[model samples]
Target: MPSLRIACFHLNQLGDLVFSLPALLALGRGFPKAQIISVARPPHRELLLLSGLVHNVVERPRGQLISKLKMVSALRSMKLDLAVLFSTSLGTAILAWMAHPREKAGFGKRGLAYRAEKIGPPSVANNLRLVEALGCRVEKRDYVGLVKLDESVRCRVRDLLMHAGIGESTPYAVISPAASGRRAIKEWTSEGFAAVAERLADDLDLVPVLVGTEADEVVAGLSEKIVDLRGKTSIIELAALLEGAHVFVGIDSGVMHLAAAVGTPVAALFGPTDPAITGPMGEGHKIVQSDVPCLACMKTSCREPLCMQRITPDAVIESVAMCVSEEKNV
Candidate 1:
């Protein structure tokens, strides 16, 4: 087989990007001589770089039309042998089509979903299908790739936590209380998170550290029991903190996926999204979700949102206990 040049565009949401790791790793191994160009959004660009799965990571900043066009020009210059799209956006398909690769494959066709009986499968399996189209079958399909942590960053985060009074002997749990702004309905109540954090502190003797971006500050502040590290650490720094966490408790968001990527125990709280589709993609993770009638609706503008409301703090705490207990057993 001749050497191939592969261009894969996977600048999706954080959870979706995490789901693509196994396929990307397999592709790199399947064609060792292939010059794989990975395209992803910020933070994820750092992740792909840390994973060392691609020859180069094409940084695609948000709201940058020129950047996208320039990437297309660069990809066209490569004369790509295969173009794999992990997302189903029309723009992504056009980008793949515009690149004029010898073969193009993706999850579900955006325009063709209506005519087809079924749309995309689970996010993880869907991404693997793109690699499968190129005649490669992955032996281990659940890998999110190995994430390399900078020792300097890890030491720095430890110093920061120590300054915050978290000693080296203290067992800490990471609590990510927010998701995307548009998907607020997917989040559990602030009171529920607070209750869980308090219980974790009081009963388990574990410090709950709230970690997220500025968007997560409100909920992180709601719980006085947690050590709010919101908007402080960079993405890689946050990964280092999660790497040391004994347990990670959060919604169906990217941080949960990140914790799973770093081999941490995750207590994934699900509401609007299906756990089977986007739960923590690793072992020894506990999922806490309600069986509400309107659960898994994937609605952005839900008025009632009982699905999120019904997931009680007790359930979350139990899930946390289960996750940490499994961690202890391991």
Candidate 2:
């Protein structure tokens, strides 16, 4: 019999794609003989490739209509047995329909064979609902042990740490103070982060290493005492770095999700967004949210985001310390 051919339409944001890992893992376990393919962004494609879940990845289309048409033609030629849309949009639904897959799976009644509706918080469970629509039993819904980092990547991160004055044996905490896109209002203050850095060094004996994209450096900055690694590492390399860290402290961002995926303990600070909807997954993670009445506002921008500003550095230090202690116990 021919191997079952599956195509996963996975064009998603970084955290959203990470949220989809458990469903992908379930797919792999359910049909071990199948050839599963994923269509995702270039960076996300690398992530799925490292997870060892999908057999191959095709770059998600970008730019003009011609590019999308080319992608549609390529997918149609494969005669996919199943096409699952992790990103449930009308446009994506149209693309899946154009591909002419034998069967289709997605959220809502988008002319698909299988459909899943929005569920409760902790969005990982919601992602699994779509796969369950395909008759796959999801025993695990966490990305903790799904993605494996190569030894080479670990060595590279080790070298990077050494250069940054962190030895391989040094206990360190990764701090990401910036949130991507319009979520800037969700960020805790730089002053608060700097104070947390000092506390990590002086009180907990953990070095605070700042990590983010170049665009985030200005927003995530601490003093010269902190080792800033913004724009220095690729996504996979960042994963390796987070994997080796003692703990990760950050706002609600894709970096926090990445840290959780690598099994690092996370001290996530939340304000404008709801933690239950998009917080870090799995165990050994701490969510520190403000007590503001307007919490979980889900607003992209706020002139005075007192919710984030209200979370003091002392609270964060306490959470970080707890995460470290819990990790040590583990």
Q: Which candidate number would show the highest TM-score if scored against the true structure?
A: 2
lDDT tens digits by residue: candidate 1, 182-263? 7788788877888888899998989989887777666676667889888778777888899899999999887888888889
Q: List the residue pairs that clash in candidate 1.
A: none
- Candidate 2: where are CA atoms >4 Å away? 64-66, 120-122, 219-221
Q: What is candidate 2's CA lDDT for residue 97?
A: 86
Residues 65-171, candidate 2: write the lDDT tens digits. Answer: 89888888988888899998887677888888888999988876756788898664326778798888888889997778776789988998999999988998888
Every model: Cα RMSD to truth: 3.1, 2.0
**How high is the CA lDDT of each candidate model?**
0.79, 0.85
RMSD of 1: 3.1
User: Model 1 compared with the native: what TM-score?
Assistant: 0.90
Query: What range of 10 consecutive residues in model 1 has the weakest lDDT sum?
Result: 111-120
Estimate the TM-score of every prediction: 0.90, 0.92
Clashing residue pairs in all predictions, respectively, total 0, 0
